[model samples]
Target: MIEFVFHTDDVARVRFAFSPLWELVRGLRVLADPSRHALHLPWVHAVRPKLRGLDVGFLRSAVPATDYIPDFLTPPPGTPLPDFAAELEIVRATPPEVVAEELRLTERGGAAGAARRAMAAEPARTLEAVCVQLGRFWSAAVEPYWERIRDLLEGDVLRRTRALAANGAEGVFADLHPAVRWHGGTLFVDRRWDYRGELAGRGLLLVPSVFVWPQVSVMVPPYQPMLSYPPYGVATLWESSPAAPPDALAALIGRRRAELLLALGSPASTTELSRRLNVTPGAISQHLGVLRACGLVTGHRLGRRVLYTRTRAGDALAESPSVQ
Candidate 1:
């Protein structure tokens, strides 16, 4: 069992902000009579544990722990995060669109396919605990994302979120996060998901909410958690990035492969790339093979699919033709 520490101060802050958030949620529950409400219930339920996980992450980050998840996966402390109203509207804006897309996914092979693949990734008990831990660990630091969304989500979303903020106060959670409670230090935890075997055997992935939001998420080898609320017809679809350090690499190597690299900028499955580039999987494989050999690209295995990413070499190649 993973050891967990809870601070009294953290609890007080959480109770302050969360109590009201819950109240608003309860108010939203009144609309349960509609089909859309039914659709949303499961997502709300699924997010509860993740939200709590984020809160725990925030607390741990404050202790200045060495084991830290990346900042993007978890929100930074003291950041004014997005509240429910904004999220509700974001969902509403494209609710039908998302629903239709999900339905289409189901028509093909998607979450259900992935979930089925993930079943044996860990022992049943371990799997259940991980799911719980994922949520508990995440909520502690879920704010930065909320804040990013708050600033980015405007128009219809802004109006509704502001209305809720007016009722709940915009800065409600400003002081609720543990990061704000204690002295500042670098806080991180392992948000990376681990599977015992090869990624392909278990539907491997990395889902940065950014993938969906800012579209920052990329699938790489080494499985990332799979979030689901099938009952609600909500499923996340991610394009995987090869786990070759695009961030570090993109900066290190930025020019030689600029055209080839940028052409491959969006996340993709091996098969998808083959089709898009008008190349055979084997031909694409040859290019990726050479790239990987040169450290110019990296390959990540996800659920029987391999996603290729441009490595520092590739990024450097992109950075300049003179890098060589």
Candidate 2:
């Protein structure tokens, strides 16, 4: 068990963030063991053939079977939400010393060792090469689905923030994952190794992940502490079709609008809705505008993007049995 002892100030400092770089790193796990992550199988199958030409050896070596991927390769996100290109640049510029030290931690034998040696001998050149491959890989595999994935992550953060306000840190941690527990001022994680650390004041960053489900993971200290857990509403990613609404509700709002209302059972962005409904963003914007004007859906700006959710009346209308 890994115990994170939080100080009074630490509690106040806890925040949520999303890392494009971290997601790239985690995607390696999905690529390495596609069958193990059945939830991501659809994504894995789609990206597998494209990955055949990419040089992913260094990334694979960094994340050995022990789950001890180096921190330098995947830095904590610079912002609450980071752009993929910006984060990729950060990876490209990782200090040579940091890169060498991290790579040195991997097993010093065979192909893994050879890769590490090449990186250690010329960190700058090797890192640029790796980043080039990552750019290509991200373009092919992750960029297409990032908007939907990002919205789900943001929604999870919003829910957790509300939980924190209503019930405090314990409440927020309680349901984060079954592998995680909060008691007596200590956050305990059921990890393979026994460990303990005091978050003197740096607090923690909670990161929501779609791919890293079933296991809760932490980046040990010396870096800002971060806990990555599966996000809420992950199942929606693989939901190819939205659930049907009552025929009367569909008729009342027009089938497309009703479908959008039912889909807004959770908060989502315009792009997210467009992808889910297989409609154009302009079409979704028009429908959402109408829904907003009718007081059926509400939109709120979160960072640079605005998210929409159903109002109480909207929920009632969508769920009204009389409509059937």
Candidate 3:
């Protein structure tokens, strides 16, 4: 179990941010183990051939079979959200010794080990190559959906932060992950490796990921400590087409309301629904307002965005029989 001891100051310092580089790294996992992360399967299929041409040696080492990932490869996000270029620069500028050490820990031996050794020999040159490949990968696979991804991530943070505010630390930690627990001023994270760290008033960074589902992870130490958890609505992040509304439900509440109900299979912001339906946000809001009034949908404030999701009643309605 990994334990993060927090002080009163540490609790106040907790913050949320997004990592573009981290997404690129986790996207590699989707590539390596497509079966495990089926949510990303479509993305993997689309980008797989393009990836065959890139030098993925560093990724092989950086993201190992085990949950442990090199912290240097994915540095803690800077305050707010670090841009992909800025974060890549941080990785590229990592001290050679730090890079070698992280790679050695995760790679151990085999092709991954060999890749690390090669990188250690000429750190700057090889780091540049790794960065270039990552940049290209991001543009092809991630940039297109970054806006939607960002909305989901930010919404996750908003909901969690509100929980913390309303119900205190216990409320937030309780649902953070099944593997996480809070007791005696320390937060425990269940992991294969053993780790214990003190916040020392530096606080903990909470990041939401679309691809890092089924495993809640933390960056290995000697880097700023942070945890990455699957966000609230990742299951639908890659949904290519909105689900068709049930015919009976469409007849009952108009096609637009039925579509809105089906879309809320996961929490989504007005902007997201608008983009998905190719309608104006105002139109989406009008429908959402009606759904909210009828007790079919609920909304929560996440930062400036309000994400809406189906109420239990709404779910039943969506699943009700279609007109014969």
Candidate 4:
């Protein structure tokens, strides 16, 4: 009854917003404190559904398997893998460039990224593989009413909303820290174990699938890898889950910051957040500049415009009780 309808084009928005939007959700979960995380839901409600669909849909695609990510939703600890539609876990961490380095074909026609392979001979096997991957995501957090979910994922407004979630190009890859890069689409990565390890160095942990498709593997970093994986229990999450960090960075900042924080929860043009908050756009920009300096905010581009959001640190600061 959540009435989560979205325009068909919004799904394209999800594809565009695939990255930043994932970080936003992770940031929200990290800044779990009520006052700090209190993003006016109703205000978000007024956002065009196509745009809202992009936010919601991108998050949906980004969720990791429940077993590896405990807080997400899964069976009890020490329980069998029955909870997962796909039975898998990384028994070993592969090293960097594993995907491109060790490319092997399950069949013909290049790799997973090369486009749909020749599967006419084994249509049933191909169909089975697709089902397994779909089931894996479903078990992770796929909705009961998937058709609606799909519709929400795919919307034109979702595409336009890209400045907030995925398509924004800003500091997206500005890290010396080596990354595996498999998580951002472009597949057939599983053949190379080294690539798997590469992502881990950058904090992305892949949950391997026993039921192999051509090259489908579920990746996990931190519950909030989008904001630069906080170097705490990211490794122990699946191998051994960690008690949620008390110093969860996003859980810290105060009221004014919290309001600004929530206002920027998704990327918003300065004019947008200002208009929403009844403040001048210049005033909003000033606050954002401060937040950015502290590593608590980031910006993205949409044409000549820039959109802003709570950085991982910003979310943490906003959520935390004021130490000051």
**lDDT winner:** 2
RMSD of each: 21.9, 3.2, 4.1, 18.4
TM agreement with the true structure for every prediction? 0.26, 0.86, 0.81, 0.26
lDDT of 3 by residue, 19-66 (tens): 888888888787778888877787877776766666665566557545
Segments in model 4 whose C-alpha atoms lie over 4 Å from true places: 1-14, 17-255, 321-324
1 or 3, which is superior by lDDT?
A: 3
What CA RMSD would candidate 1 show? Answer: 21.9
CA-lDDT, candidates in order: 0.32, 0.80, 0.78, 0.33
Q: Model 4 compared with the native: what TM-score?
A: 0.26
**Candidate 1's residue-wise lDDT over 1-324, tens digit each?**
111122323222221011112222221221222243443343445445544323333222211111212222221112123344443333334333323333223322434333322332333432334334433333432332333222222111222233335533223222222211112211111223322222223321111122122111122223332211011001211112222323444454332233235444433445655544455767667666656677766765533445555555555555554432
Residue 209 shift from truth in candidate 4, angstroms: 31
Candidate 1, residue 204: how far the Cα is off, in Å? 19
Model 3: lowest-lDDT 10 consecutive positions: 104-113
Q: Write the per-residue lDDT of candidate 4 for residues 161-263, one digit (tens) a residue.
A: 4332554322222221233131233212222323222222232222211111112323333332221222111221121111233333325444444567755
